[model samples]
Target: MSASVANPNPNKSFEVVQPPSDSVTSLSFSPKGNYLVATSWDNQVRCWEITTTGATLSSVPKASTNHDQPVLCSTWKDDGTTVFSGGCDKQVKMWPLMAGGQATTVAMHDAPIKEVAWIPQMNVLVTGSWDKTLKYWDLRQSNPVHTQQLPERCYAMSVNHPLMVVGTTDRNFIVFNLQNPQTEFKRITSPLKYQTRCVAAFPDQQGFLVGSIEGRVGVHHLDDSQQSKNFTFKCHREGNEIYSVNALNFHPVHHTFVTSGSDGAFHFWDKDSKQRLKAMSRCSQPIPCSTFNNDGSIFAYSVCYDWSKGAENHNPATAKTYIFLHVPQESEVKAKPRAGTSGRK
Candidate 1:
């Protein structure tokens, strides 16, 4: 049994009151903090308002909307008043949160939309589809503002201001400088040998992290001169059993990042020091998605079947979905000193 499940600590961590009824595909915290939006295979997009009083935390359901099919991804607008969600229905819907109005279709794709992101800098919403194309939507217009093709089906994507990294099927990594939203900044093959599972850009926009199905993560720097600093590391493996790395999220404040895997474990790592900062006890089920709050004070993760093993392996009677919130100590997320330096030991 996982330590967290065995010993529930209300002060350090707590489970939200109500969670998605099905597999949670993605999680997005409001840029303004206090709100969290989750998209799930149940075809529902739900919002919750997070509140804290002393050591106790609670979540109040704010609003919920649905899609025609499983919602794959979601993102919040910079002002915190709107949310954009996409799904297997191949449609992207924009929700005006404050107004409590019905969602409207703002974008469409030829196939399932795998990822949806709000490019605040460009004031546009970008969607990546399994149709192997990326489309930027202006919202006001009837058509996409711009569309860029990918090498294969879109699997995962991460954006930080001007930097956007898209991981597609066939191990293709497409990088984009959002400043030049219409063109691809560069394209490269994934450093990891297995299929890409998730990708996250570094907080500084210097590079990005890519996780693969073989339980490994590749740290790649965009600049040629920094290529030598790039490397891949193994994680989430227990002896001979290797599981896919399902999610990667960078700390908004500390810059160190965390990786969740199909093995039901998550670990924080400092890329610069080449060391693991902290590793949480494994859960009973896979963690399909996770994210940090705006200020990085809390980490939210969903515990559920990832569907990687196919529908045959999923037992509805036995499966239970949960969303947990963990508050990390400063030492747990802050970067440690590099080798040869005396520090927090």
Candidate 2:
């Protein structure tokens, strides 16, 4: 078991595993919880296997494939036999996992796909793109089964409670009811002066967590009939822009949460106290996205530089991918300390 600390300092020490050079733009873990997939500005998607015997720092990727443009987002299928990615070239592609540990492209999108997600129970795929539209595709259909348009550019999104919540550059969130195709259920306004970068909903779909560029996170209750806000908190210090906020599956199970930001830092918070328990800076470049493993034992993140370099020349040498292993706390370490000085005979 990994070691744990009591009210651990926000800067508690943890292990970091670095992947091959590449500016990581997006990250997702496999459904089976054995691997992690990362997309980078190098137009490549790489997968790494998770192991508990201490990460092999110099190990190469288990699989890697090229895209036409910078891959902005990716996700794995429910069966873990395929991976999907969206890129800057206005395309969404599917890759099938072969028995020999190789991936082959199988499908493509019409526009630059910004995000992709697979619904396990419905056996459907959903995608959001710069075309200002959200499309739902049936695995068996050749064309999109449904599409929804948004008023502004979409940055990030998530689906919960059969509803799609989309974050936009305009600092607003739109909730679309999947059951009722024609209904626009709610338009959530952020309490920030800047755009909303990311949004995540609780596993139970009872509440949601929204991250803003102004470095704040708002927790809201989901209620269709009432328009009341439950509570909100300043998750980060005043100046650091919260690039992303992802609720780990472990957090719900362990009552803890984590957040990443442009400041190149990751913070762990306890739900009960709403206090920051741990913090660590993983990269010098900005972290665009991050997600926890299915088992909640590990998480992955991607780092890419700001506008100093040209987009086409964004090589893997300049980009980096990081995986953090959660060190479990020991019962003795978490136990209360006794009072008295050793010299008091």
Candidate 3:
């Protein structure tokens, strides 16, 4: 059964009222408000409104919709009033939140869609699928605006304005300059030695960070001149027992990031200083997905089985899923003075 533990600090974090009926696959915060959306393995997409009253935080279920198959990923439009979700059903559904409208299918793929993103700069929706292709949808049309073949099935993707990075099954990394969305800017293999679990672009758009199942992360820069700055670090391990780094999210303002892992722990780090900032207490179950709110004031994480052990180990009868809202203190997430250097890095 679930070995769930009590909240270590109730004031810092609180559990959401009602979470998904199944494992949560992804979590995203709206760009303009306190609304958070999650896509789950139960074929459902849910949105929650997070609010804080002095020292207490609470969540209210807002709106929800279902996919024909388990929803894999979701994204918010620039307006924050709409959401787009993709699933194993091979379809992308657009939901209008503020207007209280029904969701409608906007795009389709030949295979399960693993990741979805809304690019305000391009005014299009991008879907990466197991079909081994990256398709860009215009939303205005039934067909994709462009389809680019990938080296392998897309496993992870991260986008930051003019920069887009896609990590595929074979450790292939494809970087695109969205100013010219139709062409690839760079193609390289992952610096990590194992399959990529997650990826996040640097807020400055100069590089990207890739996490692997081997409990390691690689920091890569785009320019050859900055090649010396590239490095890798090991994390999410207990002695010789290592765990996959399942999610990586950069702070919107600080540029520092948080990494969640299969070991049921999460840590904040300053990439510029190459130093770990804070390591939170471990949960009873793995943290499958996590994200920072638009302002980085709140951190949302899912405590559930991540399926890293394959289908044989999942025990639905005993599995307990939870969504937590952690109000981060500025000192906990902000960067510190770099080593051997005075003042901020």
Candidate 4:
């Protein structure tokens, strides 16, 4: 049988979903909020539906596709009508939603493709690679229409309309304004010295959150006045070793966000109040990726070895891993008014 976890704490109840055979590298919620696609080190992209009723996994994977190498990342496009995935194979494949269709190889990269994002406003697909380049694609034809060199291999990226932020391995941020594809956009130095692990946009698009492998996260604002809202926190660390923060995403409605890390835990923080609302139960292995379903009703996370120590950590004898479906309590994320305890004295 596949792995499963049932925490006795009714308040933090969650259901284990059908898991991939190998490690999960990333997870993304479909735009419609009904399903989620997980890209895994098993060389497969698996899609599973998110049901409304319980903390139980309602169904098995709706579809599963394979890649030549271990898949690393995935994203939805056309409002969930299609999906795109990339991996160590250096190939990007587009999968259609309707049943019985094969995926199309959309493009290729010189090195592993670290990220694949669809610019809905521009109707284009952008991919960042360890090859030290960012390329824009037009699905109608082969080969990227434009390509720009980067200072270093891109490890994380976040988009909040108008602006695109690419965080590289060398502690540099390459920011771009979607409107003017050209022109050298702004460059921002990172606040931390560790390798960037994840970057997520704020709901309002004014700034973003950057998380590092050293268990440090910094808040950044685009303008001066909002800069006061910025803050930094150290978490996911135990004694000396710091766990890598694997994922960061904002709640669509509440504007709050959740952070997951290699320590196998998820924590909800209310940025407006500078307080942690909750920290979910920890699993046996690390949670490599997580995301909130579009409507904010459900959250999915994969628990597996994320290769943080490189191939040396891979153990074939390791037990099976899993993906879980959690229904966060409304009260846990419900935003508090300024007068509430999270606000002022």
Candidate 5:
């Protein structure tokens, strides 16, 4: 049986929606919040419609053959009509929501493309790969507008407030000013001596949080002169290395943030207090990716496993997709005592 836990408030619940494919690698919600996009090892990107009715939960995935190799990451454009995906085939494919669903492939990297992000305001597409380099592509042009080399392979990245943050396997996080995307502006080293699996910038763009394999999460200030740990949390005290951290998002109107790890669990915390507010049970397999809806009222995750079906098998190829609605605790509406009862005792 799968174990589960709830917080004092215990407001949210999850419903598992099986995808047509088994090895989903990443999950993203459309800007409109009506659809969820999942990239898988099946070399396909699937779009699922989210709905609740008739006492049943289901996902309708719009299957489209877009990549030749396993899709590693996917993201939606600001307009929500266009979707972008990168794969092991070293190609970045763009899928337009209209027409015949034609995919435009862009050859930008030599090695597997690990992550992709689109800057809507500047109309720039940024991708990082196993090539140890980050490239910025102008969608209007056929070639990469700029490229910045790093010391190690980059796995995940987040862009906000015109600043780009890249997470590398070298246990370092690099920040670049998009105003000058051609140069590396700052770097933050991990305190636990472990590689950063994922990095996410706060919604306010004032700081960022990094998750490491050592099961430690570090929050850092963004200002150059004020670089320091704002808060730290030990996810696992026994020192179990967190294989990966996929989903990180802040609530739409609150200081709360959510995170999911390879441990098959999702955690919610107050960014300011650094206190874990809730922990929810996840899929039995490792969660490879996660993202919140634009409104933060809903969240989704993709659970993936390696393909080893033997005695020492830990990672499997099959994966599952899940989506949940975050239900906030209802505030108590206490009625004030009668004015005459104040000192009666």
Candidate 6:
């Protein structure tokens, strides 16, 4: 039994973490699997140590670093020595975990930085922005090494080492090979009608997942021969109320992905079998972001007024923003086996 599930709180289900003063835009677990980092509209990126063997959550962050504007995204480098954060200030900062956890601007985006991804093989970082461009940074330098212009602002992105895919505001599915960053890429039409809100690369790197605000998801395959395997489904919807699919994170080894939504619900799905293995009870408000640690034992997610069109209407109880920590059982994180006919996602 996982520590969290082994010792349950009679008064609540999951452990709640309260630190950020505003909406949390993104959450990531360190590669070391001992901490959870969050970027928020509070204009700060905060880190919290995980008590893997216990259920209590620390009310304070291990480190909190500020940005000029609301930070939208964050991720840890392959080693835990550094953390990269991006914000509405259009700046990307590298925060050294040592040295009092101070930050230094390493690069700048022409617009708010919506996402940051590190390419370990090339030892570079790529950022997407509302400026309709993706900038590649060497990290050791101050200026971008290369830039790729997009047709519209980037809304979501997913990367699998050599293969990268980004979803733009106009629903253009832009795919590229990072080994040759400037190589001409494939641009496919997104199958969803609403803006793409989140994406996740498949375990095999053969294709990726695309999610939209209309409570729908597209399972995409890269090759024409696998077109029949590509399909779309509806989720994040309840009766007549449609909710945005706020985020998606795949378990590091299981390929069972989790989805958080504006409905404040979290679901675990086996992408290969297309079966929902679990669903968390409805939370107070929307959950903007969620992530699994590299080992897939700890799950962290944020529930808040996600700045969606009708966010202000959420009740005060639900308006209280929070990051919840869940220590899932290994069995719960494992992907379920289906009949032999079930195929890859």
In TM-score terms, which candidate is top? 3
For model 6, the local distance difference test gives 0.81
Candidate 6 matches the true fold with a TM-score of 0.91
lDDT: worst 10-residue window of model 5: 328-337
lDDT of 1 at 328: 78
- The C-alpha lDDT values of all candidates are 0.89, 0.63, 0.91, 0.81, 0.69, 0.81
lDDT of 5 at 310: 33
Off-target runs (Cα >4 Å) in candidate 5 are 1-20, 52-58, 236-244, 306-345
After best superposition, candidate 1 residue 334: deviation in angstroms?
0.4
Q: What is the C-alpha RMSD of each candidate to the true structure, in Å?
A: 2.5, 7.9, 1.9, 3.4, 6.4, 4.6
Could you tell me which 10 consecutive residues in candidate 1 have the lowest summed lDDT?
Answer: 3-12
Task: Give one digit per residue, the lDDT tens place, for model 5 in 14-59.
Answer: 4545563556677787876567787887788877776756444356
Report the CA-based lDDT of candidate 5 relative to the real structure.
0.69
Over the stretch 1-345, how does candidate 4's per-residue lDDT look in tens digits? Answer: 134653222234455567788888888888865777888878999887766553454645688899999998899995778899998999899999655579989978999999999999988899999999998998997989899898999899888778888999998988888897655478888877788999987777777889988888888887778777788898787789789888887888888888888877888888877878887777767778888888888877877778887888777676356777777787667666666456422
- Expressed as tens digits, the lDDT of each residue in 256-335 for candidate 1 is 89998988888899898899998888777888899999999888888888999999999886577878888877878999
The numbered model that scores best in lDDT is: 3
Q: What lDDT score is found at residue 218 in candidate 6?
A: 85
**How many steric clashes between backbone atoms does each model show?**
0, 13, 0, 0, 4, 0
- Candidate 6 lDDT, 157-262, residue by residue in tens: 8889788998899999899887788764689889788889998988788898888899888889988899989888888888999999989888887878888898
> Which of 1 and 3 is ahead in TM-score?
3
